[model samples]
Target: MLKRVIQQFQLDVLATSEVEDSHSSTVYKCTLSNGENVYLKIPFTKLKYQRELEAYEILKGKVSIPEMINYWSGDEECPGAFLLSELKGKPLTSAAKPTTAFQVGVLHAKMHSTQPPSEQVLNGMKNEFPNWSHFIDQQFYSFAEDAKYILDERLYQKAIEKFERMKQQLPLSDGPSFIHMDFRPANIIVDNEQVSGVIDFESVRFGSTEVDFSKLYRDFLSYDSSLYSAYQRGYNSIRPLIDLEKVLPFYRFTDAFNSIGWCKRRGNQEHALFLEENLARLKKWLL
Candidate 1:
């Protein structure tokens, strides 16, 4: 398969190594004989391949997507693959000035500015819910059933009750926009406090921009409240601030619930306990 990709691209490779342990794809770093390097992502699933391939096409000239070097796909049983130029920079998590939340917000604002086209994959999906509250309620119940064995009944019931009460507070929104659902520090690349690139478009979707803000808040804001102001300043510089402050608490609750579900299923005692501790933090808003 590697030989086919290199031959298809008519490129000479010096060596290749597995660089990213992707859940749905195998990512390889190919250093060519001439010292130029490129990444090869071979999908283990059709859906992931289709999404990543199409995502790159849609995001081609609009954003900081990697340049496609070569590609192949559409086999029922065989994995699809593509080659891309390597994005230069260190991951924001470990980079200097990593806490520069302003940069993060600016990048997201830039992405959200590009509305998803009507025929975009995520826009085509017909996911329905009566309202945001119904969605949150369903989230709790959907995982609540499975959580019974994973969590102490008393703790589980407390969470359900708390989130149910928050249901009334769920805010309404205008419509969906293109966003990185997994918009976190790890997926961002930073150079000298500026974002050099945003990677991982597999989970790209047209959804409430708040869904992503919630993720950012949960993953970063909780750790540093200073980021809230910096991020807002940067984001608003691109577009006027909406009611993000008013609605963020509700989304934070939802984010916590999602984390709880993931931790429960992971069955890691430490992670589960962390969520239990998280409950204490959430009480500030949920209660």
Candidate 2:
């Protein structure tokens, strides 16, 4: 498949190595004959491919994301692929300084403030939900439904009860803004203690900016109080930060529930740890 893509797109002679193969896509780091590096991404499904392409178009100029270099729309038998300019940085890690966390917040704030999609852009979006609240409702219920058989019977019922409570308590969404549904440390890039870029847009959608913070808080910001403070400062610099006390718990619970569902559906051995982690979280919240 890689060779076919290279020949069809006439990518320059290069060396390549697999970078990540998530449920959504497989990515490769390709070193060009001239030593320049780029990313080649092949989404596992047509829907995922289309989502990322649409997101890139919508997010351009407003966010620091990978630049699209080349693309091939796939046919029924083959999934298509695209090339992106290599971002220079490692994925954001716990070791990153508070400065990097601040930049991460700045990135989210900028994304949230992005202009609503133009009518023409909306026409092209196949995945836009009616509103942020609708999207969250769908996500929460969908994950809960999938988790029914996978979770312990008593635990699953308890989770459903908690889900209902959260469903009722969730606040009004802030905007019809661009949101990276998977915004977390691994999707953010850090260079010299500064956030340099964000990647992985296959889950991007038009939703409440508040929904985007759940995963970031679960995986990054919640780990350090000082870092969280810095992040709030940066976000407030651009736009007012959401009242985390009111929203974070609801979103975080849903996020963890979604992780369990994802792991259950994918059924990868590697997902065992994630499954256990979310199970622990759910137990802590519900039991």
Off by over 4 Å in 2: 123-129
Looking at model 2, the pairs that clash are none
lDDT of 1: 0.67
Please write out the lDDT profile of model 1 over residues 51-139, one tens digit for every residue: 67766776777666578877887355556788899888766652234246787777778777766566655522222322534544666
Question: Distance (Å) between predicted and true CA of 165, model 1?
Answer: 2.4
With candidate 1 superimposed using the best TM-score fit, by how many Å does residue 251's alpha carbon deviate from the native?
Answer: 2.6
Poorest 10 consecutive residues by lDDT, candidate 2: 120-129
Models 1 onward score TM values of: 0.78, 0.94
True-vs-predicted CA distance for residue 130, candidate 1, Å = 9.5
Candidate that scores best on TM-score: 2
